[model samples]
Target: MTNTALTALREPAFPDAVITEAIRWTEQNGPLDDAQALRLAASRTADAHEGITQRALLLGERIGLQPELARARQWAPWVLLGLAALIVIAGLGLAGNVVGGGERHINVIVALASLLGLHALTLLMWLLGLLLPLGSVNTASLGWIWLSLTARVAGGKRGQAPVLVRAATGLLSRAKLLPWAFGLVSHGIWSLSFTVVLAAMLFALAFRSYTLSWETTILDPEFFVRAVQALGWAPAKLGFPVPDAATVMAATPATPGAAGQRTWALWLTGCIAVYGLLPRLLLVLLSAAVLRSRRKALQPEWQEPYYRKLAARFTALAPASIVDADPGRLRGAMPASLPASQLHDTLFVIGFELPPDMPWPPAGLPAEFAAHAQRIDGSAPARRALLDQLAQARPRTVMVVCHAVSSPDRGTERFLREVLMHCGECRLWLAGAPDAGATQRWLDWLRDTGLERITASDRPDIAP
Candidate 1:
């Protein structure tokens, strides 16, 4: 693969133009069958957009849509983090208030439940999801909303973009890359927010003191005891202390000692830290790993029906005749020596579709060169008639004139090839001032056609 094609698959910029260029190349290089060309073209445009080179409109790098998407969403991460921080701060405030003053007993049930119960419930649900598939449960998740939100605001809907960009924009359910990126970012914020919540909880505990006890209007002591015991089981295994059966039985709407309060606080915070903050942090890392793996797997697939049809259509064109002086290779082709014009009977100068504004037998034509040269249109019909004429006129040296400004297309390439076959001696002459971009395209066509040299004299006014 050329660097440009690899880039086309990688960056994903303006791809339509690149496909057009690849198609054109396949048309001219007939040895490369349509399927091969189409596969190359499809692979390049499958996921990325390609940019055009400024001067020659040649294929350039694949512009990455993700970077552009990120740039568009630059403020999103900080904004999401800010919102998460505020929510965590608010949750800490609500969870921190010790509901005891006169008796110095923080309602033990509320105190632990406020800090750890929701997180434990969430962890239980997560475990349940793993153990048993819950069909059609509409769990509330901020991740989904945030991922789609990033897609919408990131120009994921740019006009006529490839499947990947469309997926990033959420037009397809199977967008592989964009969602991963959003997931990585969103999970990171969730992890950070949970960490801050844990920090706030610990900070509050440091400055304040409250005793722990539980009060129940309906439930028996056994029910509360079993609930606390079950919630503490996992943390207990990791060495956190659980209140004893005696403490549970004696627990009432009354204050306890500072040591008791500290134990209860540590047990609650330990559960939240282990089951909530830590698990969310792990999810953040997992999402990041998934995103990285997906990035490595990013590649263009060419097996679709759409690409197959294009390949068939392109291969259907009849190929033109070509000659092979077959040079050693692309680099530094050795130009063959053109014998002097005086050695030929007739020096025919053929004008190949020169623009009306540009005069024929353009100025700066050497007196020795122009005197023996005669002009003729370089079109197919004109060449066909000229072939019969040439069969009889039998010009010894036919110098075909083409502007250095115009890119070499099939018509001109075939004309020169046919003329070279029929004439005793022939050479392609590029007429006009040299421009690097046009000259390069022209020379590439010449090399492909097995014709490698251009004459010295050129008329400089034409542009293609």
Candidate 2:
């Protein structure tokens, strides 16, 4: 078989023994038939595909890559842009009024009202994004809650129900998207409602100028007649009316044309204000309703005590105490009672007693315990036996100090997995140097096997 094929067969999904037998069978037969080769390739491919698919599924569920939530992310930007447009229009109106020369500049009340309306509209869009299920979006909706409830009910039942329920519950419980969705909808609704009310107030203010009017020069017929008479007289004497005369005529009382122009301007301004506020008002109201419904559906209850009890029970499985050891203390603190054989058993920690031959550190030892130690590779059968003995001597929780190996092999991962399987109910914490990439891969493997990595860090408190 090609190296690639050989590598594929070596994956954990395929039994090593089975691959070895197949290879041996092929080699001894020498020049297999086409059918035989095809069978071998197919078997390897099946194993590889299964492994990849299983890993992908576990990872996806862990990260809450639900269909609904994915859709939400896609449309979030568009909603934000709509909100921005409302603000831009309101700002332009305010700027235009501020810059234009008039007896009254832009009404501060109207400008403020328009701004409030825009804010309301923006709020509404945010709410819609949160509450309405975007089609095909991978959202962690009520599905997670149902799965968790089912798990609790079926946990101890016979057959596949318990297993299936537990699997579903774990996926839903760990996923973050559901909680995030709740928070977003809650906050968005509140914000949008406030904005909507503000927009309405602003719209009312923008219409105030149109609703209330006062007499002006433009509204006076006498000013119009006199102004026109002067213009007619001026055209004969000069090409343009004199500056002083023009100023006097311009200030003359309003005519029907001037009154009509003023009325139109007032009406247009009022329309602009109302039009700008309406969409935002609608959006805000829609968002508020969605938020209210979601809140009702997801009302929080009192469950703290129950969760605390569960946490306490889980932590009870850990061993009572462990000796604190760091990289420097490895060699001297090796436990003496450990047997040299069986170190290869994997997941065994050999703790050595401080030997007289070992050198002491410059600082004096503390009153709490005897000398410190280091971790040794327990993969060797002899070393594993020694470590196993020490583990048995102490309470299962006794921490062993060990020297950090320069290059711990991949077998360490196998050993950790074996330890977890053997202990079953016991929680395992592995302390080691910083190596985020390797740690993540090991953790992912553990997760796939229905186990969790309690902690993996280089901090002194966590160091073994």
- Model number with the top TM-score: 1
Model 2 spans with C-alpha error above 4 angstroms: 1-65, 68-464
lDDT by residue for model 1 (1-464), tens: 11211121233432332333333333343423333433354434432122111211222123343344344346345445555666566665655464324544567667666765665664454444334434211122344444344445554566113322343323112224433343344445556656777777677677766566778888888997888788778888888888777766666654344245667777777777776667767766665666544543442232222232232232222244333324643333332322343134665667777777778777766554576555656644456556555544546666767777876665665566456544556656566646666656666666665566543234432221
How far does residue 438 in candidate 1 sit from its true spot (Å)?
45
TM-score of each: 0.47, 0.21
TM-score of 1: 0.47
Clash counts for the predictions, in order: 10, 53
Error of 1 at 354 (Å): 35
The TM-score between candidate 2 and the true structure equals 0.21
For residue 301, what is the lDDT in candidate 2?
15
For model 2, residues 1-464, the per-residue Cα lDDT tens digits are 11211221123422322222222232343532333333333344343233222332333334332222233223333433444345445555544453332543333234434444554454454445345644222223222333333333433233233333333222222332233333333233333443443454345445543221223434554553454344334332433222233333333234322223233333333343344344434534453444334332221111222222212222222222222233432222211221234122233222322233434321222222233223344434433443344333322222233222223323433333323322212223233435666556545544443334433322323422
Per-model RMSD to reference: 18.6, 22.1
